[model samples]
Target: MGLVLGDAWLWAAVEWSPPAVAEFYIGGGFDTPTVVALLVAALVKAALLWLILRAPAPGPLDRRAKALRRLLYLAVAYALVLRYPIALLPDAVDAAFQLALWTAIDVLYLLVIRWRSRMLRAAAGAVFAVELAAMADVLLDELDLPELGSGYIVELALMLGGVAATLITLVGQRRDGRWSRGTQTAGWLSVGVYALVFPLDVFGRMSGGDMTVPVMMDALGYVGTVWIAATARELPAEGRPADLPPARRRVIRVAVTAVAVLPIIALIHPEATPHLTYTGWSMDCYDRPSFGDLKPAERDAAFLCRARSTEGGVPPMFPDSLSDQEILAYGRALCRAKDRDEQRALLTRAGSASARSADQWDLVYVCPEIVGAAHPELLWSTTEAEAANAAYIAEKNAKCRDPWPRTKGVVQATANYFLFVDGDPGYLVHDPEDEAADEAAEQAMGKVYDDSTRVGVTDSAVLIGHVADVADVCLTVKAFRTPPPQRTAGWDQVNEVPIVSRSGQLTVPEMGEGGEVGAGAPMPNLAIAGKGRYRLRVYVRVDDAEEEQHLVVVFPGASRKRLKLKPRPVAGRALSFNSPSSGGRRAVARGAGGRSQAELWS
Candidate 1:
């Protein structure tokens, strides 16, 4: 049974990210709110252990009674070791001693508890130890520490205690010649409970839900096993005090434990918003991805504000062509070429590493962005080669811009927009002589680019835009409205919606279809207004197949508007216009030099 419960915890840790357990896996050293929670839990657990120890013990023990006592002590001690492995260890030899200790405990549990299967206990211990060790390794990597940090000693002690208790229970069952009803029930129920509880715990963690739920479940299982075993198991007559009812005492113990742990579990799980804020994009993230792994669609939400908007049954403008990966690669390439150091810094800030592939999008994009600044020679040579390439692309698709830097300083913004491609995204340094040289270069570029005005920094280069002004720039998601055949008079858009910032820095803007945009939602037809440089995110849960444009209309003084896309559905109706430009609508395919770049990575 002891082995079974241990296995339960092991399975939970590996198969699913149990909340408290996940920290250990993610290089537990990256101190976050969750880490703090673990520390607090350790303290609370200690208090509980102290209280349990002080509780009055039932009198003289029969063999079974003796076993139960040992089991209780072992479990409590093991729990402590898990939290503070070095509490009883010497400083220098702590790590080595801890590993040895846990290993010894495994042996003790398997050997001592004759009734409980040895193999099962060993299996559980092996799994648990491996996971803990893995987590410790991650933590060490995060800290750049050469060795696993302290805590193993404590874990070993705790394991030892749990083993002792399991052994005691088996002895009692054997001495009685047959298992008591409660003992038998606990053993069976434990197996089933172990299987179920850990899975639930893992699922909850992966889903990024409240951690409290699973921890509570564990406590409940533990207490339940104890309660069941105490009540149904025949008590050894020698250990019983005639005056006290063992059943009642056991119930009290269970109740007290449950009550004590309730608050502890609550403390372990708190409302956490795992959103990371960075330049250009606001992201709600949990585990940060490796830098290069971020897909283009994810980057799009931050860079271009390409979230789908729904109104009047209008289908959102999804880049029917681009895959998320392609988009991100393109974006990275563009950023990197134009602004190498800064782009590298961005990836680093986002918890990503530098690029290994020169053919990567970051490299490609940077090639053009810094043609004059960093790659002047390449710019001159590539320009001619690019022109030939452009001519070929232009033949295939008029919408495609063959010469990437189509116009001097102009880069195709997407199939939908244009940016000056010739101009460097920011200034770059040629080879720096030393650290001091690098700093000097950065400072010089900072001044040239007006770092104070720029929205972000690219290594030594400034983005050459104000973060606030950048945030205020209106990046519209254009939707062509195709009204329904039957337009109703009362048919007005349910105006309230949000232009969420993916970076998670600013509070979500209030937007709506009509009237004043209230808190939380915005009113449509209004310009998306705000003060900071921010990417807009629009999501339409509604199924409207109408063409509707979501616009981020910036008002002076940092106020912004979220124009709700209220397109009237066109049911199989073909409406032709002389020109898209005639009605002030931007032509998506106006310029023909190369194939139109697809924004959505389909």
Candidate 2:
């Protein structure tokens, strides 16, 4: 009876998410709190075992069953004691205490009297060793060592222990004869539980499913095998406790455990398809393509094809082998060209890169923005691009300009993203003078990310993570003729990077309704219309409990002839992402970030 009750208690813990667990199981009174159920069950188990001292041994069978039950109860004791304690002791001392607890459990099983099976004892040792390693992870943590495989250690150990126990039970059933059919069946059922659980723990996570799924599966299996063994009354025992109980009693125990565990899992876990939370253009061709793999023309095409909003969901035509240098030269010449027709003719010249790809919308939209002071080359640009640019500047001047050097505005923090204010998304995709881009990418993702890591930064973009998931942020953008002697008051973090613009037009591109499937439209882009390097210093303040503020300041930079810039690797959703619960309202903080909602890549 005590063992049967333990099964129900284990089920209660399955609703582990806490006060959120349903007040009533189904049509009412399943209202047991998880901790209360576990504590009561632990006491009941201890009480039943201690009562053995007052009476003669029931039989060898019952004594062996009691021995097994004692080891199982320690799981609860471990939680009540060590697991719940806020370890105030030194690292080595805490480690030693846990080691001691596992050692005592192992000793108890080793002294199993009459019906001991060698394999079952071996399984106990396996459990002890695994648990010690899992628990000792905190020691390495305290020493400030890198957490090598710490996240999955406990789950892996549990799976391995289940494998050990399952095998031993099956082997013991045959070797220790005197087992009834029901007892034999219980051994096989344990094996089935392991088979179902191990794969979900491994594969489910790789596929990006919620982690809780596998844990819940393991819980169901745990409660199940215990229920089966409890009802069959079959284990290596002095009285051949492998003997089965009456059919009616067996039915009652089976019914009790099933009723306790299955209902809660069914009621609590939502049935939903897996939603992959990746950042990329909805129509993007691939992620972080290797520049070295493509020829010059293909590489240029690849760059143009990357996350940029084009009309009708169509990607821009290849750059037609047009390099940024060639385009910049064309813009410089157009500076001397006389009228709109001459400017149009200059771009439309036969066999030129511009003429060869004159019909592409991105090139058209970007052409005017790049050649900032040139003729109104509406022939190579679109009305929409012209209109967006005009409105953007007007809004900027109204809010940011009147304030003189600093312009304060509310940046739309949509879908947890902001800006990639580069003149070109494909900047330095093919430069050979330096390998900084590749090295920077390797460094950004070279190690596992920790909980505090809210963002990823590469030469391509600055991944601003909403650590607190703030939707809209108040910020100021200022253009400086030179860097300030020191950071202004009120900012908490600071960094300066060189911005390279091919067209001299820097833009803040944002995602629209299409999400990762489509390269998003642009917000107002800054027309820094000269092909030169510039310094951008960003100051971020996140200490505000309600809002995040960023100060972006840009200034001219001297040219460096050491090496050509390497395009940095982007990480995460380079385009954009929306959490399932996001209301679809867009508010992005895209100052140092890049075009499209996709922020970065691996």
Candidate 1 Cα deviation (angstroms), residue 256: 20
Put down candidate 2 lDDT per residue, 203-300, tens digits, no spaces.
46444534344444534444333433332343445455434468955874675455445444533432342222221243444432333334545533
lDDT accuracy of residue 186 in candidate 1? 44
List TM-score per model, in order.
0.28, 0.29
* lDDT values, one for every candidate: 0.34, 0.40
Candidate 2 has an lDDT of 0.40
- How big is the positional error of residue 392 in model 2, measured in Å on the Cα after superposition? 34
Clashes of each: 98, 45
How would you encode candidate 1's per-residue C-alpha lDDT over 140-259 as one tens digit per residue? 554567744346675554434433444444544554443444343344444444445544554465456444444435344553335333422333333432333688658745744555
